[model samples]
Target: MEFRLSEDQRLLVETARKVGERFGSAYWRDLDARKAYPAEAWQAICDAGLCAIALPEEHGGSGLGMLEMALAVEALCAGGAGSTLAQLFMLNPIFGGVSIARFGTPAQKRALLPGLARGEVTFCMALTEPDAGTNSLEVRSFARAEGDGWRLNGRKVWITAVPQATKMLVVARTRRVEEVQRRTHGITLFLVEPDRPGVTHSAIEKLGTNTLPSSSVFLDEVRVEPEDVVGRVDEGWPALLEVLNTERIVTTAGLVGTVELAIRLAVDYARGRRVFGATPIAAYQGLQFPLAQAHALGEAARLLNRKAAALCDLGEPYGSPANQAKLLAAQAAAQATERAMQTMGGMGYAKEFDVERLWRDARLFRFAPVSEEMVLNYIAVHDLGMPRGY
Candidate 1:
């Protein structure tokens, strides 16, 4: 029932905030304009060991829990780099390292975890295909059995960090659709090396979060050894559920951070800008009320995010809460960003103002990880005990 962060957690958040502040909004805006990666900022976070906070100490990490990771992400967003940078760091722990730490074979962990902890290697998940947007169960990618190994063939679109990733936690079907008892069954997870001969990637021109790479990945008969299988073959649907829930929670944490940043920017601008005769625009109720409302919504979303992360760390049943957190946080972030843009008036449309970039970045939250519609569906069935819509 403890609501406050521990002293150590507070320190972790403060350190992340300092690192994020060093980069500044101008740096982020410039990177977005040039469509460049935040290599320096990422390296700084690595040097601070923030990248490895959730990894086990044996793997050269601090072995922190998901709550600490969420706090760090929120702090990074609040410090001004926006959600794009927060998104970059949040994935390393939840989607990248957690899978290896939990399901990877001993040899796999020995080979990958240490390097991942040191940020020497980065990973991205390949789940969504051109055909499998929200209906991930309809994945067309197949992994055919080959002499004590497998050969995977598929094209995955909207894969993040593929160009920079050394490994991809790919989900592919091993058994044909008719062979499985259920549609969700017969799928398998594989940690495939992206640098292999059969794999090729092309970057996509994206609207926001342009600093981080997002590309379409083509896998042409990529060879995978037996050791590459994560968890068990044809039982990957369950493993993927775990990964999805974790992704939802962590991604929402980053969005909560972005909302905080947007609120701050709006407040600062309102206090500085003069509208009528003498006082600042913030003196008027019109400007102040909306900013207050944004702050309240952002705070509520932050609480929900922390609650979801805590449940995840405790190994509690978190699927519903995770979805709820993501849905609420993303909605709050999008609203806040839009309001911030409006609060800034003409300057908000300009890239130099930074809210314009945040506005673009906020739009992605409503669509990625899981969409708002999907979250509502989950709640209707799982939380409300309603009949399945689909």
Candidate 2:
């Protein structure tokens, strides 16, 4: 890859950043305090016509690809909304819409894409079960073929944005693990309406980003028609991989972008804050060097994320790169937030400064979508050709 953005890409980034700043950090801070949904921010993002950046132009999108999507997300996070707005992007654009655009049958596209492109539709993924955190293949959710449809029954935990979303991308096992030749064989993906007869959600109290709620979703014999399947039944693992990898890119972009926000918060605070003999805290090398190192790590992760997204756009093997990018992005964001809080001293713990909120939000990145240990395991086995850890 050229490792540079085109003129049009720059414009997209600027526009997204402006939209994000229109809400600003104060807006997000208040939302977290109130534990309110970001209805106004969501509508504003939809009004900007930014949701369809990764879909084909024929489907009311910009005819762009994953790299552009990541760019827009990064700019939005940097603009000031942070991961709060980035999660909004994750629900509609990256997870639900992009996969449907790529793999959904024509009828499914016609039914879903227009609303998705306009941001009229919302989605929450029902991928994680209580017992199947990192080992998704262990999901006990079963979809049994009956007559012309399937009956889905199981529970999903830690699902995000469940209440507001019109749809849920449910992952279930179409066949028992022992019945399949490989552990991955039975996994299937379906697009089910959250309001369907047998589905329910109970919000899970979480750490931060209260603006976007997480929940436990219950499914009891939910009826799904053949048209609801995103890809072939029991052949959906590949599509699932695509969805997950894109999520990594989207999330990595947001984390990378928010590094700037956190760093700037600390830097500005340090420059003006003074205690000992009128000397500012910014003069201290102890503070300066860590922030500088955090900046460098953020930049490196951004480059890696871009490369992974570019590979995704080109239909190349990007699993290793995407996981690597996400791993670095998580580390970089965590470091930035921790350092920013350290720089703010007592103010960092105070909600009024907003670095504390950023700190709380960034702390979850290393665990979700994938974990740091899992990424390291993958790299050790796949990239470095080491034996898989027992």
Per-model TM-score, in order, reads: 0.97, 0.98
Question: Which residue pairs collide in model 1, if any?
Answer: none
lDDT of 2 by residue, 58-156 (tens): 777888888988888888888776765778877888778877887889987887788888878888899999999988889999999999889999999
Write down the lDDT of every candidate, Cα atoms only.
Answer: 0.84, 0.87
lDDT of 1 at 59: 85
- Against the true structure, candidate 1 reaches a TM-score of 0.97
Q: After superposition, how far is residue 244 of candidate 2 from its true place, in Å?
A: 0.3
Backbone clashes, candidate 1: 0
Report the C-alpha displacement of residue 295, candidate 1, in angstroms: 1.7
Please write out the lDDT profile of model 1 over residues 26-142, one tens digit for every residue.
899899889887878877888899888888898888988888888888888777777787667645665678888888888888888888877787888888999888899999899
